[model samples]
Target: MNKTLIVATLALTLGTTAADAKTRLLVNCFWPSSHFACSEVLPAWIDEVERVTEGRVTGIIPPKSVAPPPDQVAAVQKGIADVSVMFNGFFGESVTGPLVAMQPFVGSNSAEAMSRALWRTNREFFADEIDTVQLLSQFVISPAELYSQTDTPMNSIEDLAGRKMWVLPGPLAEIAKKLGSGVVSSPAVSSNEIISRGVVDGHLGLDPQAVQAFQLMPYTKSTTAFSTPIYSTSFSVFANSDKWAELSPEDQEAIMSVSGEALAAAFGARWDKAAAAAVAAYPEAGIEVVEADPAFEAALTEAAAFVTEGWLKAAADAGMDGQGVLDFYTSQLAQ
Candidate 1:
């Protein structure tokens, strides 16, 4: 063959190779499509991924979640979905590093700050805690406040003890149980069913945005805010290890440029904004909001001591300095 003919053939082969090298990720969102995470956060991150990688890497959210919230990490591990978010609470002892952020009365109300701090702390310590998937980023939602549908606000441990409460599974549930509150523990997605059905007289595991998103506003008569968050849920944005490994080193680096702390900041900012809107609408919705008196706050602090102790023990068992890690996370929040 002539030189021109040989060159033309090589060009076509290279073009086909480039096309075959492109990757398309199947992203799953457990929340409703109308939710900010599905509608905005994931999509925005996908856009950045594509842009940074020059269209070599792209992702799309499926019409529905591939698995329930608690099973998200497993689904990704089994390759049922290429990427998804998992709530840290669902894994129990399987995931301990993130529990630092979930400790009662520890985190700030600002999801952005808390999220960034969690990511940084995770990277520096306990990085091996989650080895099943490629951990991409981390975030914490706004801190949960006490919301009651009962005759009176839950201002003290006695008030809380008097009512059966629905709480987000994990630390919050444990805290309520310790406080002598009759507890029904489940994922936040189930909050509507339990609250609307009056399965519990109060709830203790949702930020204002979640309260609004889960449609619990109608069922909640009063909200008692503490000096610090009663509790917060931590989450991990992760990808299937196999799928992540398939990407070229250059593309992987490109994607990382827009992930980690950048992604956490984006997700946290959305939570903060949505929560603010929800809180501002409280008056119009007729949901009475009251700040917890110092006595009430002190009572809760005393009751929640065990949660912190348990976490510190777990961290030590995992060969981590639990108190040091916790101190680092809280110090980052103050900054």
Candidate 2:
């Protein structure tokens, strides 16, 4: 008998059923159980995997996430969990490739398009950077808009001078510094407390849905909506390489067929809807959403050059064609 069959016989002798012989994948979800990723995306993906594989593969969520957000990639790579999704920037300098998606004003306003573009770009140009884990998909969320807690909206570059704003580390902080704004570096979880206590005058890098999610909407007086998004976060759904190798070739193909760009599009579309709904409800919460005027656009155009150049320099350090990636991304979004 073949070694594979022999192993199966041995496993059956150990009192495991035939159904138990199927490969089981454990998805370590970092978001809260109530979060959309946990409540919807994972479940739907699991269903599709099962259906496509004819029950040869199945997936389950753990009682809780195995690791925090920043540790998710390592957790999956080391096999602490078989699968997980994580934001690109949360890992800091260790991650590469997804940086292209995080750039300001490069993506389509349509999250679905941006998400698909990210997947395609990563596959074409940066797969080596993320080969530690098996990538199932890549995606970008809806772009974030700037919000101010005060009644006076920030409309121009001059308006940002000396104004304190909470910014997550990355391009946003760099942009804030370039504009001569005081930067208050804080994680998203702590933003509510910091902003509520007036520790900062406003914040950048969150969409309307996030503002509501973080309870910033109640405190926000006006939102400065840029024609292009100020920035978007990149995310990946991935699996442990060792775990992936254990699956049958057919099962692997089945799982992959339903993942990647397909899953990315789903995530992007859902996020876009949530952001739109949140923006629609802003007036009921007594917050004004202001579109950026020509002057403000001119200033943003000038300010973005610095952050973009910095990203390109960093990309070059990583031995990547930063400009090529950016150009490709723009063309993809334009489509």
* TM-score of candidate 2 relative to the true fold: 0.92
TM values, all candidates? 0.95, 0.92
Find the candidate with the highest TM-score and give its number. 1
Question: Could you tell me the lDDT of residue 58 within candidate 1?
Answer: 93
What C-alpha lDDT do the candidate models reach, one value each?
0.89, 0.84
- Which runs in model 1 stand beyond 4 Å of their true positions? 1-7
Write one digit per residue (lDDT tens) for candidate 1, span 66-97.
89888998999999999999888777677889
Model 2 clashing residue pairs (backbone):
none
TM-score of 1: 0.95
